[model samples]
Target: MTPYIQVVTTVADRTVAERLAAHLLEQRLAACVQITPCTSWYRWQGAIEQGEEMVCTVKSRRDLFPELCRAVRALHPYEVPEILASPVVDGGESYLHWLEQELRPAKED
Candidate 1:
């Protein structure tokens, strides 16, 4: 798998989503964050529910997942925030390079 990953989370509204995105970008925790409106249906507290939400897709390195999760939890209003990561197995070379450049430098072992 590639060193890259995409983290996803949903917030109650566009404002909160934008704030979360900005925080991640400002902290260099994400190279890019794409926000989009979405309709969600899930079981919460043993009851079926539906809501309009904004999804934030964060592009960053896999190694940053832990820090990213912490950052999201800190700002997310939901008691159980959704923070999921999926590996980027492949991507356009130039685009990947740009993504890497935009993110913070990887820590040395």
Candidate 2:
């Protein structure tokens, strides 16, 4: 398994996405979270639905995926929030290293 990954999830609005992102970063569950505005179409409760959504892309180590999911779920408003993780097959060495560093546990002072 790749050591790096990106977790993807969608929220009803930008504000929710921002909060989740901030929480994830503060908890050290993700190195960085990027929010994007987009339109999504899906079937929910047997009905077709379309709406504006903010996509959150969380970058971090693969080992932190579970914690990241849990954090997102906690802040997410939807009962069933979309949480998906994908491996980063390739990335700049400097960027990958930075990501790992950001997710590292803070040393005791």
Candidate 3:
């Protein structure tokens, strides 16, 4: 798998999603964040619920997942926010290069 990943999280509204996206970009934790309106249905507190939400798809390196999750949780209003990451197995070389350039440099151990 590639070192890149796409982190996804859902917020209650567009405002929250935009705030989260801006914060991630400002912190250099994400190369790009795409926000989309969505309808989510899930089980919460033993009850099935549905709502309108905004999905934030973040393009970032896998190594930054931990920090990214922490930042998201700090700003997210939900008691248990959804922070999921999926490996980017492949992508366009030019786009990947741009992604790397936009993100913070990887730290050395």
Estimate TM-scores for all models: 0.98, 0.92, 0.97
Ranking by TM-score: 1, 3, 2
Judged by TM-score, which candidate is best? 1
CA deviation > 4 Å runs, candidate 1: none
- Model-by-model lDDT, in order? 0.95, 0.88, 0.96
Per-candidate RMSD, Å: 0.6, 3.0, 0.7
Candidate 2: global Cα-lDDT?
Answer: 0.88
Q: What overall lDDT, based on C-alpha atoms, would model 1 receive against the true structure? A: 0.95
- Residue-level lDDT of model 3, residues 41-69, one tens digit each, is 99999999999999999999989999999
* After superposition, candidate 3 runs with Cα above 4 Å error: none
Which window of ten consecutive residues has the lowest lDDT sum in model 1?
A: 61-70
lDDT of 3: 0.96
- What's the ranking of the predictions by lDDT, best on top? 3, 1, 2
- Which candidate, 2 or 3, has the higher lDDT? 3
Query: On lDDT, who's better, 1 or 2?
Result: 1
